[model samples]
Target: MANTIYFDEAGYTGNHLMDPDQRFFAYGSVVTSDEEAKEFVESLIRRYNIQNGELKGGKLVSHHKGRKAIDEILREFHGRLLVTVSDKKYTLACKLFEYIFEPSISDINSLFYGVGFHRFIANILYMEFMARGAGAEQIFDEFQDLMRRPDDGKLGALFSASKHPDNSPVITQIREFAQYRAADIKEEVESLAESSVGKWVLDVTNSSLHSLLAHWGTKYDVITAICDNSKPLQESGEFFKIMVGNEQRLKGGFAGNEHPMTFNLSGPLEFRDSKTCHGIQLADAVAGAAVHVLGGGTDDHAKRWRELLPEMSILNILPDKDELDLRLGTARRNVVLLNELHARAKNGQDLIEGMPLLIARLTHRLNLPPIPRPVG
Candidate 1:
């Protein structure tokens, strides 16, 4: 008698974010008893006063007062809500330039921090060029986000006295790191974005689901997950297994007292249409609301839906510079790693050439398996 989780995707674009129609990408789930799930759906049907096919977030939020009704139902839900949201713009940026950013970041903090660091560096570079009176607005335009997070102490030290020539030491260090190939970082990062959405699915699911499971900590003997029917994601299954079965990769994020016990499962995963299953609709509401709230939304009908809902675990995978962690320790590991790699290689080519050996060594150091190189 294992508990089941009804999973669903609110909005998804299999293609890159450039698609004009699809704006946000979200995947989420509701874990509860079958009885509770059934009751929830029945309650909704009775309240709506009509037979319906499925509950869709896009439609649920559309009516004049539909948003309020949706949130109220969600607030009364009897299970935990977990949602992973992505910013199409950010996802696309990382996807298109995988070489510069490692899209395979394990958690939300790292993803935002890593991307933040890259932008911060770009700003420093542009500033350096401008200092030499060679800065071109168009060149900076190539990277939309070039501002450093003002709160991060480390970057603060570097950019604080940027007006004074004496602060050139910190800037020189970045230039040096930029000059070195540093373990083929740019190439590795770029390649990390190869299957754009694939990387995103794996990382977001791993964090959101793992966080949910960990919160309970061995309370349930088995967890059955049912995702909304659609094109299957390769990582969805494996990454779920890692969190449930216990994998060392989570240590990078699960450390420091927030560790969760490994979750066990009973059988294979399932898929169902939301209209047919009311539980999944509940999951969709939670997921959709989480995304809207994280987007700096305050006026939506579900604003309270974003708040009063059950155990809310919202992973806002897309955060603006303001939403980014202000502390340097936020991404200390990636920062140090990037610095190390940059210090080792003299330029991008050297780093790229030495990548195989460097990644092998780094993964070995972390006791993790290396990402496979492409085969012929």
Candidate 2:
């Protein structure tokens, strides 16, 4: 059966100097059985009052009140937020590497594949801990040993050193958490493995780019990442919109318009921009509001997805041109100019006249500074 894998990531500052341990990279995917996808579409239409005749720019109906009410409506429409699982051991280890080695962000990006592989290693360590009833510290040590001898098959040494008894309650709790986390992780991973189309979204906040490259690889049908447009700069607020655009193109299908996977990265504008706004809609808005009152994009919503699937697709339904232009003209214009300059800037020649002044004006107009650095 064909499936659509919507992915997004959370954590990991794009800045390389940032400690990886402080970052928590997450990827979440929602896989709909063919039948379920159809049902979801129908639910969306009915709940949002989406109609052929409905004007495209009208206020979309939502189940909740206030600014983010759409979150509530989406939850009421979609049933459950099925997710996949992955281990955080590698995520932790990567942070250790970053802390100890302190590689540039670009340098780490180059080792993307290795970073992802580390996460798998972490997953393996987690499993070992659960099976053998080990403490977090013991697990850490075993993980270190595995890093030294990645080829080893037998884990008898690690298991023998565990602190808890086979039937201890602590072991039970760890096992339960693992099982629960695994169910969610499996849902997301299986979607990627099974899908013939769709993209994966990732939250890069508190995460290393290496983590992503290792898991999914650098080459795919389409891979788009969303990052803070300008933090150290001036246009950070628009980062979310920029990421949405990239994800939209993937969702529309890149390549010969036939590729199966679409990858996305999202997060808070102030954070690493790895949290998927799309997944938030799915988990909290669509699933939470519809199935459980607890479902909605709150701190809990962010935390749940962050812990479960740190990477997932970020689906953004942009506002109409008129509204967007009115709200973000200067920032949008700068993005366009940045692209043009990137393509045409010869040698070290300045792309725009009075570049500093232009950026300052954009900052004044958009109320954010340090325009988003373009992805090469």
Candidate 3:
């Protein structure tokens, strides 16, 4: 039977608003053989221990309950919970901006290359499956079936690099940076894309966003989420609302931009719309996708490897409780953070704290090669 896959993104804030230096974006696909999709879902329900129609015990709790609920759950559960934390790498990278080293395209590429390649491959696999004759209905059916299942031991995940393709000047700056350390960084990048560690890095960076999109995309057939860093929130929201509300405008204006196989849960959700859905859920989905890939399954899988991995144990250091209140106070909070980080660098102040700790934590979590300490 032909394989079918689902695609979605997590942690993408459209305009690098949340973390300027680290633009967190993830694209994940749930791929399964048409015949196996049903069985896969059935297996997931039992494995994740969903009972009475409620997800229980393990990472499933956080996923079903929402971010605030996750924080509560983590606080209560404490030891070795199966939860996926948001990008500690991004948080750490944001801290790197204060170190006075010029950032390069490779630096950004290294971060995202680790993030996007696996999911991109997953997408490629879907294309490969489609080329073999899987119909859209089969694909959508498998995707939905997988979603309904409880968290299996696997988490479906992947990551992608985010850049303003339209902004050539910034692109040029990145390219210039690449020219200087192309050889060393390129080798590292190549290694990362192929390695399991690289795969997890991508997962940590993008899984949250991917999960949300997968959840929402599977719910609506004509999904049309955009990743633009240019538009203002109010403007973007009004535009999306008008588009979603008026099918005619979408049919006429958004025709070419639409996906080929329209399903029930394929409409667009704006990354900038706070009221639309939970950002952390989206991030978790991306993590879920990564876990799926790491665990190895046809389409959907459980978080077996993720649960065992040391990285899974590291507590996600979110914006401080006080900071969270201030940050989430406005619709444009993400954008504000991005602008603040960019602005603060000019004055040489570290915009975010706890970065070094994050890096050390992640390196240990992912089992990355130890960062070489400078010989004193």
Candidate 4:
């Protein structure tokens, strides 16, 4: 029996920084056999009177009765949830520009950037961290202070100490963050002759897609992918082709290059209306619950979903402030970004505009940031 993954994302506002009310874009899936998905949908349509419009997390928030209906369906639906949500702030995408280019309150084109930026930063960090290993997990203060004095010959020593080699392009790539120290850094990045912020953003997205394809292709036998009709990667046949190639550039993340596998998909991924597909309907709820927890929600529903995630499926990609010295699991992704952030700060460089709260967060850390302490 072939397995299918019904995919949906919640709180996707183009770019996380673009949405004032929300700051995350979650890519979630409900995995089951093809026959199981169909049967569940049939049951949902008959049982909940679910219309063939569109099932959405926003709608599910107030649809407690609808939620109850979904819980009932899933008890017999037989599927597991798989999801990845990008916390844009921690993911290290530049959001400094949003401050300058804030669209009018009524501007319908406000959230145009989407989650591409978040993925871009995430994939970059994952790849770079893997190449450097323990070397990548530099003390934040050391890199932060080093960036302030780029002319110091210690740069050569630091590069020499890195496992990736001093002359490798990775050095240049990692150093770019702290290279700018004066003037309008936001405009500077936007006008960079080498790369526009847009190019960097797209590059990050492509890298992330490449890494994700690697992750998915190896982990599951995804026969059919029923994604939302509106997601950016929903109908991306060409995008997938270019990204999921057998190039040496793809692998990375916490797990490293051990499982550099290709796609085992049976056919082209399809997008469907969640309202019609009970799988996506439920996927949205799970994604919504995950986001709720990420955003510090403390409601009864949030508590319920928190209890639902199996430890294996609950991947925490963010860094634990207490354990910055150790590099393991998903925290490797954060280590890459934090190192770059510190590098940039030391060099007196400011990140590009539109970074959501990252600009403030970094500023606090670079200036006199608090070291996170465990409460007794």
Candidate 5:
């Protein structure tokens, strides 16, 4: 039998990523049999005397009884829940990298992408932009505008923000690349805007769905993804279908080496109304509980709820604050690495021959012991 993955989301605020009220967006999924899902819902209604005949995580975690219900649900479905939370402002930073520093524009895109230069740069940008305040906002605002209507003015403004005096060396380097290769970046944006693909980058739901599907694809060769009806999911139905049909394994790579283990998905992605589907309701509760705790829930119960997650849930927080390290120590180290890679790429040097040197620099920054030279 094919595995079923039920999906739902919390903290969705559309393209207004920097909304102060809802700073985080989350996607949640629950994997269980029909009987299990039905029983879980019924059990919650009976155990908690739920009168609404539905359970929404956002509403439940606000009080005591509801929190207990969520706790029990976690215990009941251990290891079968997954949730991905993204810092909205940080997501914009990632979007900036996606469009501004697009790797696919060049032959070496794959190399940089494989090694997670995309992510490191995004992280660096997120931290810097958060510190620079208005400058970062200008870039995000311009980028969002460009997404809506591809205009030269918006593109120029976005690049201009990158040159903020407070921006680290990495940001300055990227700004230089964007200006020098303005045509290529602009063309990429125009193509995306024309295709309406730009929206997906900022849609946490879309990214989360991709992530959840990839996770399940590793365990189940065939999956039946059932998600709560969502605008992004509805719009991307055809895309999701094609993604699974290709049976593609979304893997990561570094230094020309690809990870063998990945989620190979070949299944159908379906959407259902939460009112009718117990699975979707369960997914809502799971997503809600996650957002509650991760979004600064400081109560005693919230702490307890967090403790239950390590065993049963996979909570992925995009560009965690720790990774961004306010002190800029980590970010500065990443800048050095990016500067080295950029130098090589700019000079048309052979990256394959230079991989070891790059790897050494990265390891040394992390304070790892050096690898011994191979005997000739």
Candidate 6:
């Protein structure tokens, strides 16, 4: 039987990621049959003696006994669980880097993206802004405004922020890129303003669901995704099809090592109310638990939940401790380069000067040919 996957999210403040209240966003899923899903909810209610007609993960994780109930669900649930989490500030930084650094030329972009250059640069931008502390808000706000409505004034302010004299290498790199390569950024921003794609880029809920669907597609032959009534998923019938069916090309990998696959979506995505769907309720619990843990909740109840998460079968998108290690050649190093960039961001070191080294290491990770340096 085709698995029916239920989806829900927590800490979704739309594209306004600068909100201080919720610094993280999470999307969660529970995969199982219709009958298994219904029984799972019933069992939770019967076990916890839930009086409410529906389960709310937010309310459940706020108290001692409530948290225990959620813990039990995480441990004892029968269905498979998956979740993706993002730091809202970091996500905004990613959007900024994509706008500013992504190449416009298709052929060059393929090679850069193939080597994971875009992600590497985005991480650098994120770390640099993070090191700036309170000063980062203006840049973030200006970029946020620009994303909402493209304007020359907002664009100029953002570019000017990049030009600010900072000893940080990332900042210096930004200045160079903006002055020499900024025309492309301006053109791309203006182009995106004419479409809805720009706004959707920061929608963690939308992006997470798309990622989750792609991951699920790899494992299951056929899937019926049952999502909470999210406007994006509801209207994204064709978009979901493309994402799931592998219409979007995979990021290029080493030839012969590429393992291409496609998702078998049984039909159109089904949106339903949480009140009536036990599966969605379970998904809500999973997402809520993930956000609480990522948000650095300090109480014993929160701590207990944290200990349980590593044991659960979940796909976490958040960067972990290994990704923060300062060593470039750490055995744990991967495509993300989070470790190196973070160390540089903290010490205000220069990544621009290390471009050749970065390219070499990244290419090594993919076992690809040497990436040529740009000619002056």
RMSD of each: 11.1, 23.2, 22.5, 15.5, 5.1, 6.6
**For residues 1-376, could you state the per-residue lDDT of candidate 6 as single tens digits?**
5778899988888768788898888888888667877887787787777768577877777776667777777776634777877888778877776676564333355445555455555565566566773335556676677776675446655555544544455455454454455556688887776676655556677668766776676667678898888865665567766544333334223443343334667777889999998889989988888888888888787887677666553334443333334464332333344345445544555534565467567668756565443321
Per-model TM-score, in order, reads: 0.58, 0.25, 0.22, 0.52, 0.79, 0.76
List model 2 lDDT by residue over 1-376, tens digit each: 1123333333223332123243222333333333554455445546555544121111221222221343443344333233222223434434332321222122332222222222322333344443543464454554344333333442334323535554354333333332323333233333434442111122223122223322232233333332222233222334333433233322222222222222333322222221223322232222222112112335443444334322232221111223213255543543443343333332334333554455456566667534433232
How far residue 56's Cα lies from its native spot in candidate 2, in Å, is: 29
Q: Candidate 2: where are CA atoms >4 Å away? A: 1-117, 131-241, 244-282, 285-376
Could you give candidate 5's per-residue lDDT for residues 1-376 as a string of tens digits? 6778889988888777878789778788888877889887888889898768888888888888888888787878777888777788778877777777663235545544544556777776677666764355566666666765674456655567545677556666766665655666778877766665565646778767777777767777777788888887787777676756456565654423333223434465777888889988888888888788778799887888678655444435467555445355444455665666566556655435665566657657776444433221
How much is 13 displaced in model 5, in angstroms?
Answer: 2.0
Candidate 6 or 4, higher lDDT: 6
Which residue segments of model 4 deviate by more than 4 Å?
16-18, 33-35, 45-54, 70-79, 93-216, 219-222, 234-236, 242-261, 310-319, 323-376
Model 1 score (lDDT): 0.49
Query: Candidate 3 residues 39-141, lDDT tens each?
Result: 4333444554544432222244335333223333233323312333344333333222211122222333323222222122223223322343223223223
- Whichever of 1 and 5 has more TM-score, that candidate is 5
After superposing candidate 5, which stretches have Cα over 4 Å from the reference? 103-105, 114-116, 132-134, 151-153, 159-177, 243-250, 255-267, 310-317, 320-333, 337-376
Q: Could you say which candidate leads in lDDT? A: 5
Rank order by TM-score, top first? 5, 6, 1, 4, 2, 3
* Steric collisions counted per model: 12, 85, 56, 20, 2, 0
lDDT of each: 0.49, 0.32, 0.32, 0.46, 0.69, 0.66
* Leading candidate by TM-score: 5
Cand. 2 TM to true fold: 0.25
Worst 10 residues of 1 by lDDT: 142-151
At residue 236, give the lDDT of candidate 2: 30
Q: Is candidate 1 or candidate 3 better by lDDT?
A: 1
Error of 1 at 192 (Å): 8.0
